[model samples]
Target: LLLLGLMRDEDTSDPEPLDRSGVDDDRLRLVFTCCHPALGLDARVALTLRVVGGLEVPEVARALLTTESTMYQRLVRAKRKITAARIPYRVPAADELPDRVHGVLHVIHLVYTEGHVASSGDDLLRVDLCREAIRLARLVADLMPADAEALGLLAHLLLTDARRAARTDARGRPVALEDQDRGRWDRDAVVEGTAILEHALGLGPPGPFQVQAAIAALHAEAPHWDATDWPQIAALYGELARIAPSPVVTVNRAAALAMADGPHVGLALLAGLEADERIDRYQPFHATRAELLARSGDSDGAAAAYRRAIELTGNAAEREALTERSRRALGR
Candidate 1:
């Protein structure tokens, strides 16, 4: 995670005059324009990559595997709409910060998710996006240093990215955490993230992002997957679910439960989630379902769930891993 690139540069223009209160108006305008609610989620993400990352049009096209012309058109349209909406560039007022911050966090999540489980292109991991997102998050934290949500978000990304070196194999295949070579983990990043989490805790009460960061910190401290404090992780996930209850969160929490209690317990928890229409199309739900079923000795059901997960998402790495799991479950 390289948030080091947000430093002020000679190429960047000087700050403009602030609004009535004398805060830098140009900076505030950039934030509002970058995270404008009117922009579609995908559009917002793309625009942020271009503007914040200072990526060349061709570089973005290469990263996303799209043509330069197409990316140019998209950016042009996005700029016009932001200008039309007259969104400001600075951080939102206290009353509006929550919604604005959520937009920024969502963009970071989207970028890291793409890196963790790339949706297209030949590579499974897009380290560039992950690093870029971390860089952007650092900028956000700098802009709102006192904001616990922003700091927690940065910490979460840092800790998660710290495990990147161990997430896959030499051939780019998926490596389950239990089987990963911990020696390859980025210890420096882990230490940095833990420090950031501590700083975030000192800021204010814990939020969903802080809870998630705590879970990541736990993982970072473990010497091996089996050494992971599953019970603590489960509790953290519980807190996250309470603060930001989503079917996906519950599904992930179930995985920790399976590790903490038993496969049967996790199976029971997941049973109630089958009707969670909010994440019906989400890949992790079926992936978790398959894992629980396999651990519960329902090989047939596990295989079916794995197959369904593969069909639901086009992320090559995840799809490949799902297919492999399905084959193993069926003893093929």
Candidate 2:
């Protein structure tokens, strides 16, 4: 028989040669592979951003809102785990695509979320993280053209990013969506995102991402806050709640209800969520509650809620914004 032992040794010993010209493809592969289901979600996201997104350890730490030392240790552990487990650095095969794709999507979404709202940084938005996320999302959508959710996610991120210009004032204070100057929005991103959303919606049944993109599209198309289709947005949020059913989604739904119906209706909805221990410390919940209370003429209660929100968040910019809101509430 042939020297089968020697052949096996060669196969095991030699690593595949790197293709330098295909750096972007390699990065994409690294992200998808690193975000494998076998790894912890947190580790997967950190490693993917660190390695594939080519973000420095400190930048990754900032995006994740953790210390650099902790992030470095986490990255070291992830690489060690990958090597020990012999996790391949290639994309998943067709049979294993679904689970791997979901993991990758989840990691990308997390990255985008951090970029959209820096969890602990002084800056209200991390443009670099947002750009990285959008780039990765576009790559994923291009690679999986048939994946409706991928397209929807890409569209959703683009639509959100399109508003980056108007998200804050010249003084770096956060601007409410209604108060943002529509003229400052990115028309190119709006066009592309709307087109992608339409394509995604055409491909399959409306998933949570698609629904979210549709809602964003509505906001993008509206000329002014008063022109927004609140009833349609409320309906979409209702559908998203049914499909996704998260506390965050419920909060958003409550906001939409407040817009569509009245402040009292939203306040009633939020009253049920106030006792939920899981989200009691979540800043958005308190902020939304403050808004609803303010709209309902409960200035004292709104001020208290705003103060609680300001206390819960670590981002200095976010704290400043909330403090301003609290001051306004107290003054009212």
Candidate 3:
């Protein structure tokens, strides 16, 4: 009878373990291994999310905006590469650490970015994904106490996340940063992020992450929207553009220029981007153009630009917000 009961219990037992407390070390090890320099950056991101972040194949694929089959093949290939190359499941040696660590940081940043603004989803923010990224980032920061970029990345995430409560209205419409309620901002996150940014800046000359963190810090420190250091923010954007040189950065700089100099100046900068085939269809480009046009008293032009932006974006929340902006622009 005892043997019979034991067999029945074994048959009914769960195949997977219920407790995951012991998996943290394994997760960290997998992340470090997946981020090995031997793998491509895309592969590193895919593998790390799959093995370390504990994301399912379909979820990772959705975040990457790729098909499940494609993502599955990518994960399989990454695993094969790891095995065939004999990449050790451990942190890199001190001599080989810096280069490898950058890839890991990039993966973590990508994860956080997807969470902060999902590639394709109904919800504007995926709280679970964002929290997971923060958890992994914290682990990375803990593991590399002296890495400025890691700390800066964490600081940036924290500072950005501090505004989560005020990012949307009661009805779930997106709220512009300038209009968000400062009282709702996470004070503890702001304080921690500021300390982290200061520590990172003290480490050495600022890298791209450090520079971005500085920008976030300035925003967080501002008492009010009008009191924000627009000149300093624009200066930081200039520095970021010099270092990064992406179309997105250019658009951001244009927005800052509108705040610092004037809407006309910002519109002129955006005009060049609008004509560029590479970013002409980019949603943010049109959205920024809409705002700058509205600020310049071109109501009709602003309405048209907002319509174009609405057409380009897929996020329902962003679309609804753009529609509202379009309505306001048209005085309807």
Candidate 4:
């Protein structure tokens, strides 16, 4: 969801750039139609993932955790509804654009997110999906050139994707951002992304995507992990939490807070967030809590949290890395 009003004080001085590119207007309109607000959130996501993200029906089914037949039926019903309701397959007029941009932006974000860090797979990074997402993002940005959030999203994807080359080790193990080799990052993409972000920020009212882009921009600007402005990143995450509250956001905020303050402070934040039962099943929550516990000198607690995280983890490389950390935490 492209939220508003939470980051009135967000820094726009160091504007980041976005990917500037062309798009097939027809394709862009078709995607907007697929993401029309008339459809259910699941339907919109499934349709956009299937049509715009270039995912096979089965892939979409797997991503959404539904049977192929069920997903097929849902897609069929959604298309029927669109036609029966006489939804236009063309771009909306200026007056109608605002109502639809939210869904379009959200679905695109989800596509890139799943691609950047696959929810379930043997491999950590899905390059094909990532490329498709970037392509779709470029289309969205081109279609809505003045939309700050659109540009912000494109910049966020580009800036994050710029570090793809260094996200894993030669042994195929996932590398944490703090440990990645900056030399391996794509400088060209970084430059392009920063430019886009600057334009998005200059558009005035910043939203969720712009805030996220700012966070990524900060990371990109840092010369080393130690040099990262943890205080500012944590503060920004606070704004993100206010704008768009989610368990995942809370987890990220806690982790960043830990870096800025102390492990105990981060653990306090997590403790409050963990009251939500959904957090129990989220891998990142446990993974982050485990690290915090380890940092706070609670070896047994860290090991236990790591075990829970390992159980929830899907990627094989990530699982292996967590296993190693678990072993180290237990002094095995």
Best by lDDT: 4
Q: How many clashing residue pairs are found in candidate 4?
A: 10
Q: Which digits, one per residue and each the tens of the lDDT, describe model 4 over residues 1-332? A: 00011112344454322212233365566677787778898899898887766666866775665677989998887866665555545566656777778788888887887788776668888888788778878876776899999899999999999999999999878888888999999999999999999999999888899899999999999999999999999999999999988787888999999999999999999999766765676788899999999999999899889989999777788899889877776676
lDDT of 2 at 27: 52
lDDT string for model 1 (1-332, tens) is 11112222223455533443234544334545677788876567677666754556765554454567878898877877665554445556555656677678766665666666666555667888788678767877876788888899999999999889888878787788888888888889889889999999998889888898999999889987779999999999988888888776888899999999998887787788777553556667788988889888888888888877788656577677778877776786
Rate residue 281 of model 1 by lDDT. 60
Candidate numbers, best TM-score first, in rank order: 4, 2, 3, 1
User: Candidate 1: lDDT of 68?
Assistant: 73
lDDT of 2 at 243: 91
lDDT (Cα, tens digit) per residue for candidate 3, span 1-332: 22112223433334322322223465555667788788887789988776655567876775554668989899878877765665665555555667777788877777777667654557677777688778877887886779999998899889988998898888777898989999999999999999998998898878778888888888999989999999999999999899877778889999999999999988888877755665755778889999889888899889888888888676788788888877776686
In terms of lDDT, model 4 sits at 0.81
Clashes of 3: 0
Q: List lDDT for all candidates, in order.
A: 0.74, 0.80, 0.78, 0.81
Clashes of each: 9, 0, 0, 10
Cα shift from native, residue 133, model 1 (Å): 0.6
Off by over 4 Å in 2: 1-23, 40-81, 93-96
Clash pairs, candidate 4, are 16-194, 16-197, 16-198, 17-193, 17-194, 17-195, 17-196, 17-197, 18-196, 18-197
- Sorted by lDDT (best first), the order is 4, 2, 3, 1
Task: Quote the positional error of residue 56 for candidate 1 in Å.
Answer: 18
